[model samples]
Target: MYYHWIDTEKPAWAVTEIRERSRRAWNSLFAEERREKAEAEEKAEQERELKEYYAEQHRFFEEMGKKNREEARRMEEQERQRKEAREAERQRKKERARQAKATEEAGDGKGKYPRWTQ
Candidate 1:
């Protein structure tokens, strides 16, 4: 039987065209939505990777800071030890001068003042 346009039915040819066009439009819309979703997922993944990278960098700096502080403390201790050693040497020299002065006073008349006539 030949297909015909009827009062209650669409023509076969027109129905086919309408169905094909509707399917194409629906497929294109679906493709666009899929592309948008993929792009969004990629952006979220990039942001997560960036956050992890920054956290690692911050940890590295924190470790460096700890090492620097330890080095500075060691240097300060060395400087303090050197200063104490110098102070001890100065005190020893002062003690020797005092002993020499006492000895000279006890030697009294053994030698006259070089600039005077006794």
Candidate 2:
């Protein structure tokens, strides 16, 4: 079947050429739209992956900070206990020295020689 333009008596070859051009233009436009859509989807997927990565990193750092704080508290407790033990040891030594001095004084002015010897 021969297609003819109703308004203009164009040659058959010109009509075929025009139809081919129009079809090609439409195909090009649709192709560009598809490419743009694919690119946008890819960009959104990349952004989602980046967000998940950052969230994981944040969680890791938070856990590390918690561990560090716990360690610091443990160390502080250990130091406090050590200080208390040292203080107790010092008090015991002082008490022993005071008792020894009192005993020596009680032995007579001969300085702990025995009561019989004095």
Candidate 3:
């Protein structure tokens, strides 16, 4: 009795189709990995830019604060000088009035000159 075996050879078209499917699957996986990597890089760059922006804003406010303090100090110094000048003027006016009163009270010849000359 002879035994019959089934044919096990694959067709040429079937082998080419299998190879094409495998190539497509590997290409899809590689594309997905590249996309994920790009997204991660973009997120990191955005975070770095945000941090830099905040730092710049902080530095600007600090500079503004320092400038305001210096301006206030300068204004205070100017006011103090003005007050000193006003006080000096008042004192000078009082001294001049006192000297005038003293000169008027004393007669012209009797104050600083001899009476014989008049």
Candidate 3 lDDT over residue span 3-114, tens digit each: 7778878999999999999999999999999999999999999999999999999999999999999999999999999999999999999999887677666636555764
- Per-candidate local distance difference test: 0.89, 0.92, 0.90
Q: What's each prediction's TM-score?
A: 0.70, 0.77, 0.74
- Of the two candidates 2 and 3, the one with more favorable lDDT, higher being better, is 2
Q: List the residue pairs that clash in candidate 3.
A: none
Candidate 2 lDDT over 13-81, as tens digits, reads 999999999999999999999999999999999999999999999999999999999999999999999
Q: Which stretches of candidate 2 lie over 4 Å from their true place?
A: 1-10, 108-118
Candidate 1 lands at a TM-score of 0.70
lDDT of 1 by residue, 1-118 (tens): 8987668778899999999999999999999999999999999999999999999999999999999999999999999999999999999999988876776666455555622224
TM-score of 3: 0.74
- Count of backbone collisions within predicted model 1: 0
Candidate 2 overall lDDT versus native: 0.92
Error of 2 at 2 (Å): 26
Instruction: Tell me which residue pairs clash in candidate 2.
Output: none
Clashes per candidate, residues 3 or more apart or on different chains = 0, 0, 0
